[model samples]
Target: MAEINASDVMKLRKMSGQGMMDCKKALAETNGDLDEAMTLLRKKGLATMAKRADRSASEGKVTVKSSGKDTVLTSLCCETDFVAKNDDFKEVADKVADAALQAAPGSKLAEQEIEGKKVSELITELVSKTGEKTEIGDWAKMSEEENTVVGSYVHFNNKMGALVKIVCENPSEKLQKLADEVCMHIAAVKPMALNKESFDQEVIEKEREIAKEQMKDKPAQIIEKIVEGKINKMISENCLVNQKFVKNEEMTVEEAVKDAGGSKIAAFERVAIG
Candidate 1:
């Protein structure tokens, strides 16, 4: 049997992100062949992932990247908060977001490449290093035309983020400020859609049904009126343009945009990690 030196073990650990003991064992098993040892470590990581496939990975970070008229948001989820906050983990998420932004709007980041390796492979290495189930949760991209402006906000803890694109004839400083405020509102309120028109009819009808069940004791006409009122209120709450502005409660977000300069939200995306 070939002898594995400490330097060889450290080199393998650095390359594979595996534990020192594991790297040493792999090196010994591979007769000090670094490439073969790396393959062995990756296989072990994949096996670990398979064994923990049923576990929940809700804790992670949301990363955002913007360039020109495009903004991308990506979520990298892990099994625990400690791993989520790790420097290596954050570096991986940032790189993934950057790659996703450069690719097509809805392209899968995992299928993309980073540093000559597929992102999925890098994630497997991360799992091997962190000993946790890790995966990408969401990837959203928003693009605007030349006459439009894009704004984004990432919450303090990096767990939530939002991006908004506003279409305006003239992109002035005030219009940009309004767009930023709307993006912040999205990060805070978490609206379901831009407006009532965009909401799913099926969801609205289901809400109406639930409201009818709750008010069954009332008169038929009264029940209809109450159900309509409830559905309208729900729409107002879930629609971004209908929700009251956070900075100025007196006006809705739509009103604020119009007051600022008649800008309208063209698109928006919000990503959160639980």
Candidate 2:
């Protein structure tokens, strides 16, 4: 066995966030090679994480990042609220979200490599530190198209977030600011879809069926009218543009967007950790 120095062990501990004993063991196992020791420690973390695969990670954090043209949101989950509040856990979530902003639009976050390390490997390192299951819960990326702007928000608790992409004949800083406010509304109001057209047809059919059941005692002619009213009400409540604005409840989100400068919602995505 190669002689392991205290300095090398401490450096490895700092690099891997592993305990001093584990770092020393890794260093001795790798023959005092720092790079090799790091690799070995990460492999150990990966193994530990696999053993914790069945554990529930119900508490987590949400992070958001944007590059003007692209916005990304990611949720990193852990087994407890204490881990979720740890500085290390928060740092890893921010790194994951930043990497997501730069990743290929359709790429999977866990599979993507950042600076030669797989994203899942990073999460595994965190799992080793916390001694609990940790993983990426959800990820979303929204890109700004021609004549469009992207905005994002992460809630104060860091447990909910949103991204919005808007299209306009005239995109300006004011419109971008509106996009941000809309993102907050999204996080709070939890709209199901952008509009009636973007909503799922299957869900709409189910809603119609539900309405029919609720009014079975009514005449058939009145039932259609009642169903129409119910469907319209559903659109007003569940659709993003049609829903009442969270900032000012008197106006719909659609009206808010238009009042901001005739911008339309191109896309929106929300992420939450429970």
Candidate 3:
């Protein structure tokens, strides 16, 4: 058996970010071979991740990155808020977001490679280091077309994010600013759909049915009026364009866009890690 020295164990710890005892054990198992010990550590990490597959990773950071016309958002989840706030975890999330932007939108990020290692492997390494379950929760990308502008916003805690694309006949700095404000509104209000037309018909019908149930005792004509009023109110609350703007609550989001110029929201996406 080869002798494992303190120096060798510390070196492996530095290289692998594993605990001192874990590094020492790996080195001892590998007969003091640093390269072999590193591989052993990675294999152990993979095994640990597999064992933790059933654990829920609800706490995480939402990272957003944009270049010119393209924007991407990614949610990197872990088991605890302490790990979520770690600098290394945040850096990993940023790198993952950047890589996701280059790949196809909605690509399986866990299968994609970054710096020669699959992202899932990197996450497994993280789980090993932090002693917590880790995974990628969501991935989304948006791109601007001709005469369109893209904007994004990440919340203060980095747990929520939004992306917005606006189409205009003539795009300008003001219009872009308005689009950014719209993204902020999205992060705050979290509207379900862009407008009444975009809302799912089934969802509308469900809401109508619920309202009818609530007003079952009323006269038929009165119930009809009440149901219509309730449905319209729901649209104003849940539809992005109909919802009141955050900057100026007096006006709806659609009115805000029209007032800023003639631009309209082409698409918007919101992501959150809770």
Candidate 4:
């Protein structure tokens, strides 16, 4: 048996982007042979993925699979965007998103299967074939029965993606237009929540403190009103539904959703490639 030194382990880690324990184990399994260790790690990833494969993937391609009110929008990531567009990569993405649709209600990634292979094993297979790392980044599953309608926005460069799930009544042309506008808004504004109530209490408190400091020198009688006004403004500015529409300033997102056709946004998703 050959001695596997620290440098050899580091080299393997750099080449594989695998965990330290995994790299060391691979080295021992291969009798300190670097090439053999790499191969071992690859095989190990496939086997391990088979058991706990439904992990949240952080990199890959963003794909949309929809049929009327039932839809699935997912982002599958690879070590590089180059591989993300590969035919094989796209095929895997389609399969996963399709699986997500066919998967049991409320089934998560770990529970879904793609073409007889576990989700994780499929990802490892792609990694092995493309010579790059791959994983699922994010996903949105919508159903009318669940009161969720999907609106997707794919970045012009195809490097990033986003999905917005709207819960509105009797979606009309205007509502569809509004949904599309909201998708654009998500691309631009990037709000943290839908409204003030959805904001973290600590975050709200922090902003309140900041506003209070800005009005500290004001008359005490007016300070309370000032703080209240600032808090409202801050919440409106940060919440997606409260902010004025980017395309039409006359209406806020909340109003737009309603006036567009008596509908309201239910949920949303977004993605970007590094």
Could you give candidate 3's per-residue lDDT for residues 1-274 as a string of tens digits?
9999999999998887888999999999999999999888888777877888898888999988887778998899988899999877887798788779778976788888888888877777677778777888877899988988887888998888899888788888888898889989999999999988898889889999999999999998899899999998898789998888999999988888888774788889999987
Model 2 weakest lDDT span, ten residues long: 105-114
The true-structure Cα RMSD of candidate 1 reads 1.6
List, residue by residue over 1-274, the lDDT tens digit for candidate 4: 7787888889998876666777788899899999888777778656554544464334567666777667766667666556666887888788878877776545667557766767766667556556565666667666655534566666665556656667765655666666767877886787878777787789878988998899899998999898889878877798988889888899898887777664667776665655
Model 4 clashing residue pairs (backbone): 54-110, 57-136, 59-77, 60-76, 60-77, 60-78, 61-76, 163-269, 165-267, 167-266
- Per-residue lDDT of candidate 1, residues 1-274 (tens digit): 7889999999988887778999999999999999999998888879879988999998999998887777888999999999999988998998888788778977788899878988999988888788889999877888878878787888888888888888888888988888878878999999998998899899999999999999999988799999999999999899999889999999999899888885688888988888
Candidate 3 stretches greater than 4 Å from native:
5-11
lDDT of each: 0.88, 0.86, 0.86, 0.72
Indicate the worst ten consecutive residues by lDDT in candidate 4: 49-58
**Global lDDT for candidate 1?**
0.88
RMSD of each: 1.6, 2.2, 2.1, 8.8
Tens-place lDDT per residue, model 2, 133-172, is 8888878998878888788888998889898988899888
The best candidate by lDDT is 1
lDDT of 4 at 55: 43
TM value for model 4: 0.67
Residue 234 of model 1: what lDDT? 95
lDDT of 4: 0.72
